[model samples]
Target: MVIKVERVLHMVGGGGETSYATNSRLQEKAIYRTKPILEIAVAEMYRTLLPEKMVVVDLGCSSGPNTFLVVSEVLGIVGDLCRRLEQKPPEIQFFLNDLPGNDFNNVFRSLERYEKKMEEENGGLLVPHYVVGVPGSFYGRLFPCNTVHFFHSSYCLTWLSQVPQGLGSEQGVPLNKGNFCIAENSPPQVVKAYQEQHRRDFSTFLKSRYVELSIGGGMVSTFLGIKSKHPANDELNYLYGLVAEALNAMVSQGIISENKVGTFNLPIYGASMQEVKSVIGVEGSFDVEKAESIWDPFDDSDNVLSGKNVASTLQAVMEPLISHHFGDAILHELFSLLADIITARHLLKDKCNYTVLNSNSLSSCHRRHGH
Candidate 1:
């Protein structure tokens, strides 16, 4: 299918304003919380592969603000370790990657700021050799074989393109028409189809990573996921149902037309830990280094439910999906209503929490993959 690059870029730009602050804060949290996990991954890479220079890539790098935050933290840790060991620091090359539609302007601006900060603080001693933007899906090889040492991606893979087939109005059915709900609320076929799509997307993701990472290289990624034994109540399908319920309510109330509601689909999928490991194993290139599952309650501090935070979270989660399903015109109104509903229903006010899986906890797998 032909990708609507311009349309996607416009969508990103529209949402870019609010995301600046929210993404910054979220990146800080990710950097701090995930530091130990990253350090372990990097240490494994150094011990096993022993690359003279560490080439790190951030897939789905977006506007590069988060990329800068993560890379800076990783480099700082690496620098400290080198000092303690009395070994010279490894040369670092950071490649910031994303789709062609990502907002390059914002990314470049952020990079300039990062460069200025480095010049002032480090006197350019710790400069990355290359800070380049690569445009394409990370589900394919973006670099030559054996070129990368480490990879990091956060909160990006769960999104496929705007027109994920089998969803929306073209099918003449509600998005959740057949989803299993409350044990027996929906049809089994629907659940199978939903799951099958994620399996395919995830499989594609693994294959892509396999081609890009060197034999001994590793990747650390985190995504919204669930810890459930039953396949039906997995976080991905459950959240899909929740968003579908909200959309269906809006359709029934005439807040949005049935056709418009029909056009939209949730752009995210929350995989279970087992599901992630299985997919990675099937893809066959990397061993699980560390796997951790934790439920981070989304309190008011997360800003997902409060004044400015509410708008930012809505934009981050809804913009891509809305632009893909509905046109840009409706996004503002739709998200506004969504935020209102979330607030009025006191959903965010109560504690919006979800589970996340980290890769640092898989030490043995790291050793195995490093070999």
Candidate 2:
């Protein structure tokens, strides 16, 4: 009885203006964190490759809002760097990428809006070469070999389309035969499996980047990560399992069905800094110009004190998990009740206090020569 979870579609643009507000806030945070890193990355790419014209690609570009922010920032930095180096600024061809199911219509609209702004401000001569939409995973190759000068992906790599099979409610077991699970109190085997999967996924990701980027090119990535040496008992994974347990309890109470509960899974993994570096370094392509762990204050806060906020935040974070485990048939009333119960009795209230870490505090090591 292998119950496979369904892919959860994140509600991006559905209702009126309000529906897009949450996504907009999230996008803003993503842009803010990624902007400086991208500036450094593009400047490094130009310095190292010294190409006459550089082509930049934004992998997992999602909507044009965030993509444009990164692209514009990178161009500004590259322009400044070119002036310092006494060279012509590289012509940038922006590639906005995302999964095929993403809201590209909105993305294209956003691009048009930014394009107009650029033309109006720069007298149309400073306009970037814009190719509106390119769809695919960043973990796979989507462009010509060695065509991209700089690549950037932020808050995107943690997601895979689906949780690996033989885990969660569908599998009915904590430990798969060969896979690792990172749930709270997860067995040693389970944790090992999860780490192994991350290693594999990251290796593939690096190999793909190696193919996509030319020699001496670099990438700047920022993702949700954990701080754990041992594979078992990771706090973040435990948090997810706790949320999953609450959802399952709702299913048992007839508030949702087993089939519905098994419809979605959390589409993310919080890898530790060491784990990310290990995988990327082993690939031997990227120089790892910068690698650092920074906390997202917005995400770390304990805003779930109020019932309404709890329910809303729970719905935002756990909706994918719920939709992955349970079908979309769960009633709103049941979801609210489950959220209330979890907040009242089970949520980690004390550990909710979060502080933002300095970006310079990141542990950065360059790639060794020849890999």
Candidate 3:
């Protein structure tokens, strides 16, 4: 059975050992690394439109310190721009969007502290901004037409709307056995199925967002990607391939069914920059302004790789879906096995999983055609 990602997927909740909030240093580093790009996008959009109220949305904003990091980045850029221009700052409407299962309650509880911090940082003159939570899948419409002025999403678009179909036979037999995501052994048909699913999902996402974004508006997005179009044996595939190995280990001990391992696949695709540009071109709503692959923030050559740290981070992101499919019993042992495998293999020593950064400006033709 194909899992409904919106319903099943979420970061590990609460401030616990495996919670995303605690283990998200990698993503936090990514946000900071991409800050300059975000600054440009926000400043350029504000300068061109000069709207009285600037509306910004952070899609797939899982609850964490990074949740408000994007908001603060936008506020600081726009607020400073207004000062330089000697114009009053525009009212900022910020939306933090994620799937319904995200730890929004934790995010909500942290707001008071964030606001107090903001007030103190602003010297008691808080920037004119309103924050709200928007829970929904970004693969479909989430806002009214022509409302949003800017959008920022980081480490999110890699998630597919649903698991790719055709991994199984007409009689309900598994095809891509002994693996979860794309791997060196994945059959050509399995790979094509995943590629087609990503194309469909990305196209739908762009069409929906284009309808919601106002004329001349823009977006900055950063997502995990592969340096090469061939996904097999790529950095991302190897990263997830380790997890598949752990599962197969369990299957050997009869801790989990082999069929279960055969049927499950991660709903994520590490698209190359070429694939991203191709989708944007075919979607026809936005013009790609800039696109490039950035260095992997997780790679730190100065220190030896810590298997526990890597396992915790992946657990924070994958635990919910893993538990839903494989039962809670497998979580602790599963991650423990994964940790041992990482240390034994020393897989991350020189590997780099590239991140794709894109800044897209809504096309004028979209406005002219009233699309």
- Between candidates 1 and 2, which one is better according to lDDT? 1
Give the distance in Å from residue 100's predicted Cα in candidate 3 to where it truly belongs: 0.9
CA lDDT for candidate 1: 0.61
Per-residue CA lDDT of model 1 for 6-52, tens digit only, reads 34532244235655434445534655677788888887767676566
Instruction: Give the lowest summed-lDDT range of ten residues in model 2.
Output: 354-363
* Per-residue lDDT over 235-345 for candidate 2, one digit per residue giving the tens place of the 0 to 100 score: 555545545666667667777655544434344567777777677667655545556665443343453544344445446444544444445666365456655664666
Clash list (residue pairs), candidate 3? none
Q: Arrange candidates by TM-score, highest first: which order?
A: 3, 1, 2
Q: Determine which window of 10 residues in candidate 3 has minimal summed lDDT.
A: 297-306
Q: Give me the displacement of residue 176 in model 3, in angstroms.
A: 0.9
Q: Which residue ranges in model 2 land beyond 4 Å of their true spot?
A: 1-11, 14-21, 24-27, 82-87, 117-127, 168-181, 230-235, 258-267, 299-325, 334-348, 351-371
Error of 1 at 45 (Å): 1.2
> For residues 215-274, could you state the per-residue lDDT of candidate 3 as single tens digits?
768888888788766988577778788889999999999999988887788898888888
Q: Tell me the deviation in Å of residue 275 in model 1.
A: 0.5
Colliding residue pairs in candidate 1 = 289-362, 290-361, 290-362
| Candidate achieving higher TM-score, 1 or 2 | 1
Q: Give the TM-score of candidate 1.
A: 0.82
TM-score of model number 2 = 0.77
